[model samples]
Target chain A: MAGASFGYDPRRPVLRGIDMLVPRGRVVAIMGGSGCGKTTILRLVGGQLRPQEGSVRVDGQSVPDLGRDGLFALRRRIGMLFQFGALFTDMSVYENVAFPIREHTDLDESLIRDLVLMKLHAVGLRGAAQLYPNELSGGMARRVALARAIALDPTLVLYDEPFAGLDPISLGVVGQLIRQLNDALGITSVIVTHDVYESLKIVDYLYFVSAGRIVAHGTPDEVRRSTDPFVRQFVDGEPDGPVAFHYPARPYAEDFGIRAS
Target chain B: MTSVATGLRRVGAGTLRAIARVGFAARFFVAVVLQTPAALRRIQLTAREIYFAGVLSLVVIMVSGLFVGMVLGLQGYDVLVKYGAGDSLGIFVGLSLVRELGPVVAGLLFASRAGSAITAEIGLMKTTEQLSAMEMMAVDPLARIVAPRFWGGVIAMPLLAALFSAMGVFGAYLVGVRLIGVDDGTFWGNMQASIDFWPDITNGIVKSIVFGMAVSLIAVFEGYDAHPTAEGVSAATTRTVVGASLAILALDFVLTVFMFRGLGNT
Candidate 1:
């Protein structure tokens, strides 16, 4: 992505002159506070939304310029895991994993069944294939989603807050799976998350966004040693810093009617 | 004078908004129809929806039809007996049902049952981001989801309306022939002679098809346009029920005007 910027409303932009590049066969992380336009970047990359200005190119094809057919063709080569898995509730885990293949290909049912099981085994959930999405725990659902995402063996996978709302054990397992899958499949992975420690452990590079702009970015070692206050605050998990702890409001004392001392 | 002008402006703005919404819905309907071939290729999807929208509502429809027909039989008998023409009870009940009551009542029931369910299902899917997930997977939800349900309802509506009318005629039979002691042969003969296949029965079928399309379109459109939130989904479901019911009634009147213009001459 080069100088990519977008907003639902043009007047109040969510991302401003953003630029990002993910090298092939590497894991990159985009980290930021809540509502800091991290997910918007992922959407731009996925061609779900076109940037208002600038270019989003994946595999040398400009995404924003693609027509509907072109975009769908491009999307087939990419996989995305939304924040909460977004599994089709009415379908079983096996069916969810098989959906894309069924829609895009005409492979025999036997082959499709084998492929779905293989993907599920990779996610360590082959046994849970018959269960409905609502029957699984949150972490399991996310794993199912991950299995579904990589079922097609795409060259690029984008994960949006894959660690949100997971138990620590599940988070660590998910983080490990992400790294292992990236290395094993030789696919580039871009993760949008705020889980600093997990991201540092897995990612080859990091970009920290704040209020629609890249505030700080570096490798894990450099990010740890850097003196940038924004980076330090985020790293240390401070209560207040460049990103304020309190929302903007009128003076507390005045609002309570006891201002004068 | 200022207040009156402000009122006029408000009315004009409301009218324009209504027109814009109608235009959008028209475009959406076209898009849905364009995607229908793809939807039909996977016939199982539409078949499953037919089960949901049509087969599942059978109990309520049959029960309600029975009651409506029995009431008509009892009332028609009382009026006919006063005039000493009670033998025309079958024709009275059959014509009322096949011509008007069958499609209209069944459609109203379906709007509440199946139409609301479709809206709620789609709205919830949106709220949970399932539709977005489908899009990201290079699948058009309109083809995979909406079109199947639309065709399902269209196919199901006529069948359900037919079943309702059949059940209603039977109910009237039970009342007028067995209980009230009307002549069975006369009842059957009068009904067969009075209700023609082309104008009365076919017109009713056509009315039910139109109601089905109107209800299904409203349901799907409201679902697709709903805001992706819990409250928003609930509101969309409400809109589907209310909008479909109103559309069914209004379209029924308009269709009746055109289709039955020469009421007695036909």
Candidate 2:
């Protein structure tokens, strides 16, 4: 394990029982196929949902036991980029980003405006402040969501599927932006995505999750060389490996032009 | 974990949810009762919503109320003639309109009209992820979004109910004096003396408040649970109206029974 170990359990284990301590100010990416519960891991860290059997802690405050305000305070230090950017469609982009700063602080309007502008500028969308969320492209929406996420100068940023449904150009821009923001802001980031090739090129560390378990954890090259069958399937994007789409391995030899034994 | 600890946790969570639901309702009334015009930015948005709610639906409400009043006058006069109390026709129509028909019909109408409106608006917000975004930014939707509608309903219901009651009386007066050939002075005099008691008026006002609370609660509840899909929003809207309508009838029945038995309104 290369990052902080998440709590493991029998009754309700998170998608992975990863035991790797994520160093502060480093960018870590958890790469996995869809439905592997990558988002659950991030949510557990974000203090939204509690693991039924184990403890999740943020800054040493146990998530399962946190009061509402305590959980909110803990969340203030972390920013999350939800799928499709999750911008408030009812509000303009300016209001969306300003929302976090306003709720978490009593910063006066003038100071809040300056901070919101600074955040939007970081995402390179400051000019789009007056625009509604519906006007933005997918990549731009994700960027705006990123801006809102980092509004409070969060210490940790959790990005869920940043490169999902993105064009290669947009993908590269998002990847570069994620890395640049992490470095420039000196913030730790956990990117959850299935974009193995793109994420591998940028992430400092990688964890592969499959079947509610961590199959491999290490640097990009290390994980790329792992002998596990699921790891091989994920990294190589192979259709016929240990990761079978169909349930039950009983008819195991039906695919790959092989007969069942 | 021990079973007792687990049980305690379950109880605690249930209690918290109940508290939140109740708190949600109280916050709605508080916002309405204490609304200031200077909450302008938010109020501007909410006022547009209220216009569509309270004003735009006026035509249908008035039309519907018109028919109800006409029918009440016809029926009351016929029933009074049978009792050999035809001269007291105004009293029966007035009392029934004031204490019985006014609040209940308006409530049912509001549940169909504005109750569904709130549900649909909130449900759309839910489907668009607007509500979730608010939460992520630490905005309490209950306080900012829901409370005003609840209180506005409380304020509006009484006005609408009073209008409905008054319209019915006018219809009764027309039927008694012109159609049924009763004297105009006798009709008005009987109505003034028989109905319009202070107690009856108080009961009508209280019933309007209760109806407002019911409609707002059902609408907000549906909107809050609306899933992030078109189908979900449609279902939420339908449920809000139907559920609120049934709840209104039940509440009307309870209020009618309580007022007649204890308050001596019947």
What are the candidates' C-alpha RMSDs? 2.3, 6.7
Query: For residues A1-261, what per-residue lDDT tens digits would candidate 2 score against the true structure?
Result: 223234355454445455545678888988777877788788777765666545666666776688778776777788888877878776899998998887668899999999999999988999999999999999999899999989988898889899999999889988999999999989999999999988888899987777667777888888777877777788888976767767665554565569546
Candidate 2's TM-score reads 0.79
Off by over 4 Å in 1: A250-261, B1-19, B262-266
Top DockQ model: 1
Can you write out model 1's per-residue Cα lDDT over B1-266, one digit (the tens) per residue?
A: 99999999999999998899899999999999999998789999999999999999999999999999998899999999899889899999999899899999999999999999999999988988899889999999999999999999999999889988999999999999989999999999999988898899999999999999999999999998888998999999999999999999999999999999867645
Reference-based TM-score, model 1: 0.95
Best by lDDT: 1
TM-score of chain A of each: 0.97, 0.87
Q: Write the per-residue lDDT of candidate 2 for residues B11-92, one digit (tens) a residue.
A: 9999999799678756654654454342333665556546666776566666666677778778877887898888888887
Q: How much TM-score does chain B earn in each model?
A: 0.94, 0.80
